[model samples]
Each structure stands twice: as structure tokens, then as C-alpha cells.
Target: MPEVVFSVDQSKSMRDQAVPGHNRWHPDIPVAAMVRPGDEFRIECREWTDAQLGNNDSANDVRDVDLTHAHML
Candidate 1:
């Protein structure tokens, strides 16, 4: 199993704004306050199904993407 740590950023430049990305349309939260000593966390940090595909990409090209697995993190 692997682990990822998310440290809270208290930078003065931090702002309350919407994050633009896949599944991230909401306002950003204070990362420092979210995680606790034993809280569980995991993220699928891999190339998405549509990453290298172009506008003319076909259905077969989009299928069978290697989805990220769940490891202890």
C-alpha cells in the first residue's frame, strides 16, 4: 500500500475561487482542516480516458482505459 499526504497551505495568495478541472467545479477548501490523523484519502492520479484522444477519436479508442486501482493511501 501507498500513502499521499496533503498539507494545508496558508499562503497569503490563497483565494476562495472555483477550481477548473474534471469533477472540480466547486470552490476550493482549506486542505489543512480537511485531513485528520486517521482520515482516509485516495486519488486516481493517472491519464484520463480522453487525454491523448482528439476530436475525431472513436469509441474503440476511448474504451478499455486502464482505470486506477485503490491502494491504501
Candidate 2:
């Protein structure tokens, strides 16, 4: 599982605050910190396309979204 070692940006300007469901990314599950230089972990990701974004969604929708976070084992 991923662990927090360094730190995360919780500042008002650094936050990714957006509405859920309407957007694929945003209104994120907040986390603080990072992993070390040598850490036991793997990053799993997914790809969301136009089918997921719909016609009204814009590029800016995911621009401020932060996908980095720690996962529990």
C-alpha cells in the first residue's frame, strides 16, 4: 500500500475542489505527505475518455485534479 512520508499540499490555492459525479476528477479524497525514495508500493491508474467526460465536460475540469494519494493495504 502507498504511504505518506514527505507531505501534501493542503493550501487553499493547492486544493482540487470541484463537484463530484459531474466531474471524473475533483472533490478528491484529501491526503497529506508522500512516499520515501525507496518505498514498497505500486500506483494503479485508470483512463477516462470522452465517453466518461461527456460532451459538456472541458479540459479544465481535470486540470487541477490531483491523483496522488496513499492507499491502505
lDDT by residue for model 2 (1-73), tens: 5643433232212223221112223445444334667777543222332122334577764664444421211
Best by TM-score: 2
Candidate 1 local Cα displacement, residue 53, angstroms: 3.7
Query: Which regions of candidate 2 fall more than 4 Å away from where they truly are?
Result: 1-29, 48-73
RMSD, model 2, all Cα superposed? Answer: 12.7
Q: Could you list the CA RMSD of all candidates, in the order they appear?
A: 13.2, 12.7
Going through the candidates in the order shown, the clash numbers are 0, 3
Query: Global lDDT of each model?
Result: 0.35, 0.34
Q: Encode model 1's per-residue lDDT on 1-73: one tens digit a residue.
A: 5345432222211122132123233355334324557777743332343243335758754564433421111
TM-score of each model, paired residue for residue? 0.21, 0.23
Supply the global lDDT for candidate 1.
0.35
